[model samples]
Target: MFNVPAITWTLTAVLLLSGSYHFLQATKSHQLTDRVNNILHALMNILMAAMLWNLVPSTMLAQIAVLAGAALWFVIQAVARPEFKMLCAGSQGRLKCVYHSLSMAGAAVMVAMMGLATTGHAPAGALPMAHAHHSMTPAAPSTAAATLGHSPGLAIVLTLLFGAAAVVFILLVLRFGAAKTSHRHGTASGRSARTAHGLEAIGAAVMALMFATMLA
Candidate 1:
């Protein structure tokens, strides 16, 4: 759990820089997609950071503020660039925004959940999983069971969802290898964008594993 928080901070820092780059490039190039992407990612980073750090006013309303802001930015982007097909990938641009939107919400909710667990507000079922206090022997079978026994349903659901997403992104990275430029981006810019997508896939896969490990 603690390690995940550290990784989250590192990832958010990188995204902060990446989002700023898009925003700055958009300002210079006057590219509609870049502008929209900037806003979308900016909100994403903010919401993610807010949730991870357990910032003040940590209520659903604040979470909605961040998510609603991202959704509104998305709407504006779609309206501004009706032909904006690719959010961050080359050929497979389907449901990119939807994935991002859901991720934002998840980040916020995870923050709240973690906060609850930390404050001892979590339900009784979560206590064993949280403290691992069910046994004294490290090698006890009961200990192993306790690690995963409380959240079988949620573990299965999240594991499958994230596992599939990881597989899809990995295939996309492979497919993007010899792929032609779907958009009119220049050679350097196009390569950079595809590389970013590959990185995104890697990040998603790793995050999925983290969640699975925690639940398992």
Candidate 2:
């Protein structure tokens, strides 16, 4: 009977739709690589949404729905496109795939942990506020208590996974730049690179903000 925070849920939905827009653009472009990237991007957004949603004190059913939806999307993409599967098997693609896979796994663990915490299945030591009421607690300790009391493990794991994803994404972008460099130099290449760079920056910023908020 847990409910999702309205602000976080709204932001999650917005990010999800933004990813969906990218997929739609890829479909219109009719390029196989672009389409595959867009689909994978969409999957990442969905995974993110599910992760954030799981942080809320929600029921196991909601958590299952989110994880199952992400798994189903990944499975469908893997089965429906041989090229995409091949990309995932490649070195660079594997890096990106592994990052996302770890993200999904971390999200699942977080959801399970949240469920356990809510249902009193977690260890008593896992509770954040257990010993904060003592008279000898330092000011720094109290500050830490205020900030870290809520699921610090989940926040740390999520941040690490997201950072890994961003690093892999940057590497992929560099690979794309190197490939484009060998081709005929043109204004179109510059324009496209600029656009891609802007999008990547925006995505990174949003993710950073999300991670910061989780810590808060």
Candidate 3:
């Protein structure tokens, strides 16, 4: 969880919107793999939004397990042979799958970190807003915030990982936007793809910011 209320709400809004978009796409997609991918992304975004407010503490372990499985699913798709028509097929598709794997893995780690931080500090299913939004200064940390801030090494690693991913995704969004103008016939699909990349960029940046705050 983040200390800054504005950042928290902004992330929550973006995640919810992204999750809703992916959920709708999942419902609409005809391809099995695409549907599964969309569903995983939707769940990841929604759960991440919930995490910002420390919602559903009782389901923390379950969330982590599901996200870890989703990560593995993406990894399998990325490594699958071309003969596996149900999985990622081409080089670009596999690369995208790899990114998806990392995203899911990152989400799982985040859930785990929150779970560890919140343990013994709040009752199951309780909303501990104060614990989530406590001052970052060591002198007045809530119990949960104290736990989160102690692991500087892990936080630094996660911050860098998500930051780099955000930069890459933002570049992809720009590239997609530039290409969209040259390909008139693919405008709709191109726009949708760019939107996806933009959402990914935003999500990754949020993750980076949250982890960076743990260093405070």
Candidate 4:
């Protein structure tokens, strides 16, 4: 069986760091739109982290509502704030555009997984927070991975969704890496690009392993 706790904590850390980077950058720059974007990204990460660690409500209605809100929040952003939309400029930065699109798409997948679990499909790492102090380590909660395989349909669906997401992130890493490599000036932008690429690679690999292990 896969080591669920290890991956859960690792992904949680990655998401927190990524979200913090953008959030802080936005705050410093006084860019309200970027702030909103980063905040939503952070919220999505928290929702996943919560699900992974069983840190939210356990009932189907409660779970579905939270996940639905997270999912709809993305749509709400695009509709309510034209400037915050993920749609990239047509003039330049094709790679950046692709990255943004993939990020949005990946968030959507998170919502899908939560929705599936909300309906009692019980996809891997789908449990919620402990209801009481003593119930934290519910024996059933710890066996999320084993239970995942029991739902063949959800397993296959997750396999495809996360597999494709992994591929997208790999492409994103390449996209960022290429930018870093081609910039021989050793400028501030180059350093930032490299750091971003490193994070992309880690996130891609983590999610890839997660979906692969759960489906297997």
Relative to the true structure, candidate 4 reaches a TM of 0.55
Q: lDDT tens string, model 1, 30-76?
A: 65666766665655555544544555533544555666666655444
Candidate 4 lDDT score relative to the true structure: 0.52
Give per-residue CA lDDT, model 3, range 19-127, as digits (tens). Answer: 9999999999999989999999999999989989999878986898899999999999999989999899899889989988988988887876776676644334434
Per-prediction TM-score to the true structure, in the order listed:
0.55, 0.46, 0.82, 0.55
Cα RMSD for candidate 3? 7.2
Deviation in Å, model 3, residue 174 alpha carbon: 1.3
Candidate 3 pairs with clashing backbones: none
Q: What does the lDDT come to for candidate 2?
A: 0.55
Instruction: TM-score for candidate 2, please give it.
Output: 0.46
Every candidate's lDDT? 0.54, 0.55, 0.82, 0.52
Output the better candidate (1/2) by TM-score.
1
lDDT of 1 at 142: 37
Model 2, 1-216: lDDT tens digits are: 124477676768666876786777678766675576577566556655665655445445455455555554444443444465534554544544454444444445545544554454332343454356444553444354343335666676666656655665577567667666887453676656645554554455456546545554
**Which candidate ranks first by TM-score, i.e. highest?**
3
How many clashes in each structure?
Answer: 0, 0, 0, 3
Candidate 1 at residue 36, lDDT?
62
In candidate 2, where is summed lDDT lowest over 10 consecutive residues? Answer: 117-126
- Of 2 and 4, the candidate ranking higher by lDDT: 2
* Stretches of model 3 off by over 4 angstroms after superposition: 120-149, 182-186
